[model samples]
Target: MARIIGVDIPNDKRLEISLTYIFGVGRKTALDVCRDLNLDPGMKARDLNEIQVTEIANHLQKNYNVEGELRRTLAQAISRLRDIGCYRGLRHRRSLPVRGQRTRTNARSRKGPKKTVAGKKSVKK
Candidate 1:
């Protein structure tokens, strides 16, 4: 396993994909980081030398807000939305999907299991 920017990256994955395990880095940002550090995107995380890993860490720390900082920023954004009583905040408060996903059908994963209704018995004639 390679530790980059205080996150543990899986050893089996390519450097580009492995870097995405870090909090603030996505696919595009991972590619950008690799490019900036002159690292091969196809290289495995475990194959990176200590110097390369150090360089990557330095680059991330200098140029990007990641890990705890990124998490705190996201939390603050969500809190602000909730405080302002926005529609998205209402969805969040109600525990529904916020991205305009159809709740009438495939949102069962978020909505949890359905309850079964009991039928009334008929008397014999």
Candidate 2:
């Protein structure tokens, strides 16, 4: 395992794939990092030398907010939205889907399990 930005990336995966283990980094960003650093994207993480690893860590620290930093940044953004009392913020505060999702049904993942209510029984004539 290669520890980058306090996260242990899998050693068996390719460099680009392993780099995505860090939060805020996806395939495109990983490829960009490899390109910028002149590293082989297909190389396994375990094959990296100490100097290469250090270089990678330094580059990420200087150029990107990843791991805990990215999480904190996103949390702050959501908190700001909540403080503003906007519609999206209200949805986030209520733990509902913020993006105009149909809450009438199929939003159980965000709205949580169904809270069924008793329906009125039919009265016989």
Candidate 3:
């Protein structure tokens, strides 16, 4: 495993794919980084020399918000929204889907396990 930005990326995977193991780095961003650093995207992570690995780490740290920094920035943004009491924030606060997903059904992943309410029943003589 190659440690980059405090994350251990799989050595068996290609450089571009391995880079995605780091938070906030997607396929496109990984490709861009590889291009910018003049590293071969198809190269396996284990093939990276120590200097190349350090260069990648430095480049990412200097030019991008990633790992802990990216996580903190996102958390701050969400907290700010919650503090402002926006509709999205309210949804986030309530642990509901914030993207207009219907809570009537199929949001169980976000809404968690179902808490069934007793249904009314009537009997007539």
Residues 27-60 of candidate 1: C-alpha lDDT, one tens digit per residue: 9999999999889999999999999999988898
Best by TM-score: 3
Q: For residues 1-125, could you state the per-residue lDDT of candidate 3 as single tens digits?
A: 78988999999999999999999899998999999989999999999999999999999999899999999999999999999999999999999999998988799999999999999888788
Residues 1-125 of candidate 2 have per-residue lDDT tens digits of: 77888989999999999999999899998999899999999999999998889898988888999888889999999999999999999999999999998988799999888889999999999
Error of 1 at 81 (Å): 1.1
Model 3, position 125, has a per-residue lDDT of 81
The true-structure Cα RMSD of candidate 2 reads 1.3
Report the Cα lDDT for residue 108, model 3: 91
Candidate 2, which ten residues in sequence have the lowest lDDT sum?
A: 1-10
Each model's lDDT comes to 0.89, 0.92, 0.94
What are the models' TM-scores? 0.81, 0.93, 0.94
The segments of candidate 3 whose C-alpha lies over 4 angstroms from its true place after superposition are: 123-125
Q: What value does the lDDT take at residue 36 in candidate 2?
A: 95
Judged by TM-score relative to the true structure, which candidate is superior, 1 or 3?
Answer: 3
Clashes of 2: 0
